[model samples]
Target: MSEKRRNRRIKNRNINQSEKSTISKRSKIIWIGIIVISVLLFSSLLSLQFLEHFIIVD
Candidate 1:
């Protein structure tokens, strides 16, 4: 019985570790996506503003 319990505990630990790694990877991906999107939006906004300024000057 004790051996079975030990085996179950080891399995649970392995599962938990795997889950944590996946979770970390997912979070990293999400953060990278957010950063990329935000940067693109910021660049677009700046370009628009520059274009508007040029039009006004002309």
Candidate 2:
């Protein structure tokens, strides 16, 4: 009975580890998306200033 309990405990630990790994992977993807969006937004804001200056002169 004790041996069976030990095996079950190990199996549960492995399952928990796998779940944590999957969660981490998902979080990493989310962070990458956020970074890309932020870069695009900042670049557009920078270009808008240049466009405004040119438009006023023209």
Candidate 3:
């Protein structure tokens, strides 16, 4: 009975550790995706402004 309890506790600990790692990884990926999307949006806006200026000059 004690051995079984020890095994169960170990299994639970491993599962918790795995869950924490995956959560951290998922958050990191989400942050990276947000940063990339914001950068792309900013660059596109800048390009649009430049295009407008060129059109006005022509």
Candidate 4:
């Protein structure tokens, strides 16, 4: 691989995961937004699967 790719691989390999889960103050809002969107998406899928009534046009 090229030097850039090798450096990226090394950097990724050296990731300090101890602090990865600790969300920053600013990122907390973004995390909440992400969670809300994920929940909405999951609920929409569930509604489509089991709740929403659809008419089949044959």
In order, the Cα lDDT scores of the candidates are 1.00, 0.99, 1.00, 0.75
Which consecutive 10 residues in model 2 have the weakest lDDT in total?
45-54
TM-score to native of every candidate shown: 0.93, 0.90, 0.83, 0.46
lDDT assessment of candidate 3: 1.00
Point out where model 1 deviates above 4 Å: none
* Candidate 4 or 3, higher TM-score: 3
Off by over 4 Å in 4: 1-23, 52-58
lDDT of 2 by residue, 1-58 (tens): 9999999999999999999999999999999999999999999998998999999999
Give me the runs in candidate 3 sitting further than 4 Å from their true place: none
- Can you write out model 3's per-residue Cα lDDT over 1-58, one digit (the tens) per residue? 9999999999999999999999999999999999999999999999999999999999
> Candidate 1's residue-wise lDDT over 1-58, tens digit each?
9999999999999999999999999999999999999999999999999999999999
lDDT of 4: 0.75
lDDT of 4 by residue, 1-58 (tens): 6999999987886674435645465589898999999999999998886644553331
RMSD of each: 0.7, 0.9, 1.3, 12.0
lDDT of 4 at 27: 86
Model 2, position 40: C-alpha lDDT score? 99
Clashes of each: 0, 0, 0, 0
Please name the candidate that would achieve the greatest TM-score relative to the true structure: 1
